[model samples]
Target: MKKNLWIGGEYQSASSYMELKNPFNLEILAHIGIANQGDVLSAIKAAEDAKDIMTEMPAFERAEILEKVAQYLKDDREECARLIALEAAKPLKAAKSEVDRTIMTYTFAAHEARRIHGETVPMDAAPGGQGRLAFTIREPIGVIAAITPFNFPMNLVAHKVGPAIAAGNSVVLKPASQTPLSAYKIADYFHAAGLPAGALNVITGSGSKIGDILMKDDRIKMITFTGSPEVGRYIRENSGLKRVTLELGSNSALIVDEGVQIANVIPRIVNGAFAYQGQVCISIQRIYVHEKVFEAFVEKFVSETHKLKAGNPLEEDIDISAMITRGDVQRTKDWVEEAIKNGAELKAGGHSEEGIFQPTVLVNVASSEKVSCEEVFAPVVHINSFRHFDDAINLVNDSKYGLQAGIFTNDIHKALQAAKKLHVGGVMINEIPTFRVDQMPYGGVKMSGMGREGIKYAVEEMTELKLISFKTE
Candidate 1:
């Protein structure tokens, strides 16, 4: 199948194309159009042209369009899930969950569209103020550039586009090249829902080729990106004065306190660490277990990891699949080897079979190891023992990336303490760091990125606040 760029409400061919292959079986999925400099500029221009239309669109109309798109996604949920599995190598069941989340995200955006209002200011609060009224309202921030990642392709794109549309902003989307099909599918839904021409455009290709153009263009008012810290930093440095919302990398950690039921939490931790082969930004990579329960937790974790089935993502029974690229697989392998060389004990899995890295667990790993300190976007986790609650908090906060961290504790005081001192965007008291709903204010501090997403917050990011006052004589 051939997939072309969706620009100006039409499918346009490009001069070059790249084959998208299924990572698990190496089957050719589709030939995706590679956007060049001209293509990127054209997409930005299209979005810029549609800005007025989008800005002038009524709140009710935007809500209705988002509702229609949500219904369409629900109707074709299975097909969309299959596309994600093929393109992103996400397991079938996990892909379906992502589709469900995408639907919820759009639904949330639809509801937020009507609620996009500002507050009334007390103009009479000042000493000289009298007989005056003042209020603030939000206006759309012209054209937006949404750059999405390969993991959770549809849902992540929905996180950006759904909210952009909610705020009445035209979007120029550059989906990750490996997973452009899901983005194209979303564009089709928006088009079918009667979005205006040029309101939303999808350009797919290498980031190096088109990313700089999106960042530097004055026509694009905001750039919402989800990927590595390196790219996010480059965008922040170069996107001069344009609104930027970045959801970057994370080395999320989880702390397991003493006296908790180890059996109840082991499964949750295992799933959090290995779901979708651990490509998720909030996937738990570090575990600081209470020294008393360390041995018991490690044993159960390894036993559960052994049961995970590694095979084709299309199969319903499969729990694991191939990494996105051979280079990523090799990098993960090298990291595991290096950790072992540094005196880390390989508890469960330290190797790959047929390109799928096993759900690996390591113990006695130093804080400086790559798998412990860095955002190892793989199914690898390091387990360490912490004697005190403060020590656990410090251990989780040791990383430069502070996206989210979790604490499994029954103690209210300890949970509250971790929540305040974790140095991350979110703290899950009893839940895993991977636990996120569609309606929460989600973003990170430090190297994790800036701004926030999740419908209402994202709408706030995509809009500019304007104040209006009327002085009555």
Candidate 2:
């Protein structure tokens, strides 16, 4: 069945349509209505008109509706997972995990809705202000433009939209063109959960056209986006002072300290590097091993990467699946070839066919090579050796991105030092850089984008602080 645009709480068709397909199998899923500039205008207008209605609703009421939506998601978990797999080419196993996380995202949003508190300011402390009591109140930032990426379709969308609604703001969602079905499912869940009409609208079409409309529109007070750094920078510059939360790219690093337990680390390193085909922003792309443990770590890591089964996403045995498109697969292959040409040693699984790229492991990838420095949104990882702990930290910090980094060391002193010295947003002592929860403060430094993204943190970004004071005495 063809899918229509969810605008103003109604599903309607457009004159033109976009044919949605399964990139793994090339099967036609549906033709979503191609929203034009006019459609985008309508969505913005609808959200603007619905602002008072959303703002006037009590926080408890918003919490109830968000909780109901979370319940609805839990009820239709399998179907939602299937939709994510079909649309994004994520393996069903990983897709199910994403749906589970999406459920938790909304649940966290519900929890935060009731507890969105403000702070008391010391206005009277100033010499001029005597007997003036001042406090801060958080208010919704009006209509928000939520633009999500193709990877982690559901949860990323939830990270933006759930918090926007919880903060009492209407949203105009522009989901990735490849994975609009999941956004449609989100819209249905919200609408069925008794959300006010026009409070949440989903428009599916050309990202450039619709995004330009949203970026230029003054009605949208804020924009939350997750995508490439180039596009993120463009949005930031062009939005012209609009409040924006940008979650961009990363070539995340993981450091294997000397004498770490290899048996426990191998499986985690494999999963962190290749899970979701490394399309994740903070997916482990670079590994720096202490020279003493380099050879052993590489051997074990290769062994684990070999055990992964790649096939159709629906298969239970599959560990990795296809990229979003063949073009992406080819680009990954090209990067591998370029790295190999520049003195990198290919260790295991560098071949790709159809849309599935094998979990590739490389070593000796120079810092100047594309694979070592750039965000490889593919199932690829590079291993290099460092002489000292400071050397390892320096190598990891030598990139344009500082999203997240991990260190595997039992040394408490080393771990603590690295936590402070590393230039990323979050540091995991024993876990992988890919470790993330729906409730933790997540985002990065440098080119990895600005601001925080966990449900509570996102609520802060989606709202503005207003100073309320009263004069007495």
Tell me the tens digit of each residue's lDDT in model 1 across 250-293. 99999999999989988889999999999999999999999999
Candidate 2 local distance difference test against the native = 0.92
* Most lDDT-accurate candidate: 1
TM-score of each: 0.99, 0.99
CA displacement after TM-score superposition, residue 150 of candidate 1 (Å): 0.3
lDDT of 2 at 228: 92
lDDT of 2 by residue, 1-473 (tens): 78988989999788799789998999999999999988999999889988999999999999999999889888998888888889998999999999999989999999999999888888778887888888888999999999999998999999998999999999999999999999999999999988898999999898888889999999999989999999999999999979999999999999999879888888988999999899999899999999998999999999989999998888767888999989998889999999998889999978887799999999989998888889989999999999989999999999999999999998999999899999999999888999999899999999999999999999999999999888876
Worst 10 residues of 2 by lDDT: 311-320
Clashing pairs in 2: none
Q: In order, what lDDT does every prediction score?
A: 0.93, 0.92
Give me the runs in candidate 1 sitting further than 4 Å from their true place.
Answer: none
